[model samples]
Target: MPSPVSDIPAATPDLAAAHYAGKLAFETDCSDVRAAFAAGKVDFVLLDVRSPALFQQAHLPGAINLPHGKMTAHRMAEWAKDTLFVVYCAGPHCNGADKAAFRLAKLGLQAKLMIGGMTGWADEGFAFESQAAAAE
Candidate 1:
């Protein structure tokens, strides 16, 4: 008897490859973000699509706080049309990142979701920055 995991036939290797490759175009993980920052190769903008208050509390070092609700074409125009944006929210439990990505797409910009969000960063034991420190 096929186990529950295998009950549904898996896609062929080629199809699986395509599926994952497609996913990579839309999402990135915390480790890659950190690596980019460490190597000074951060070519994309990292956006924290959470409330300003939440953002001030703690956020990724290089991330900018831009709540999904405040995403407007006028505001996004500050960046080049082809600029790539990487967005994240509180965690897997939040959809703010998805909303921000959708808004960016609507404005004809490219965006990818940073999987795991702040929760993922914390899970990776990455250091965080707060607005308080920036002010000091």
Candidate 2:
């Protein structure tokens, strides 16, 4: 019998390539975000779809705290209609990022989830910013 990892036949190379490429249309990762920041090549808006209190405690630098629940078309209109949003929540354990993405889509805005969220950022040894620091 095939080992568990190989029990199911893998997709053909072409299908696998398409599947992975398709996923990139909706998802990004902490490492890529960091690299964009480091290179000053950020072309998207980064949103923290977490509560105000949690966001005040800690959040990704350059991320704007706009909890998913408050994502209205009016609020989002603050940005240009063509702005691309990248959203993240607390971690993989949370679905706030997904909710935010859904809301953005419903409002006819472009969005992508930053996979792994804050947990992934921490895992990558990234520095975080707090609301207090942002004031200064």
Candidate 3:
């Protein structure tokens, strides 16, 4: 017969904290996120946290340009609480998305990182919107 103590399962909360500290809580792979966008299930904000020049060059369709350095709670308030905000930067080496996600989280908003950033988004061959299209 199993001992009474053996029946108890180990709680992962403590271990998980150590493993997840200094890392993003929600990390969605590029393909999954792309599929969600294609299926129209992703109605959340796709925030581009890169520089203005990079943003103007090209960005995911429907993405809002909010450079990481300039992000403020007031500016982010435009989005609804229920909205699922997805943040991205230039590439894997970039930390802008992480910063943006943290800021959003501090404001009591839910934010997730697009794991590979815009470079991965571009590699997926997803269409991007530009200022020209917005004006048209």
Q: What are the lDDT figures for the candidates, one per model? A: 0.96, 0.96, 0.80
Q: Give the Cα-based TM-score of candidate 3 against the true structure.
A: 0.73
Residue-wise lDDT of candidate 1 within 82-115, one digit each (tens)? 8999999999999999999999999899999999
Candidate 2 vs. true structure, TM-score = 0.95
Against the true structure, candidate 2 has what lDDT? 0.96
**Model 2 error, position 70 (Å):** 1.2
C-alpha TM-scores of all predictions = 0.96, 0.95, 0.73
Tens-digit lDDT string for candidate 3 (99-131): 998888888888889898888877877777777
Cand. 3 Cα-lDDT: 0.80
Ranking by TM-score: 1, 2, 3
lDDT of 2 by residue, 1-136 (tens): 8999999999999999999999999999999998999899999999999999999999999899999999998899899999999999999999999999999999999999999999999999999999888899
Who is ahead in lDDT, 2 or 3?
2
- How many steric clashes does model 1 contain? 0
Clashing pairs in 3: none
TM value for model 1: 0.96
**Residue 22's C-alpha lDDT in candidate 1?**
100
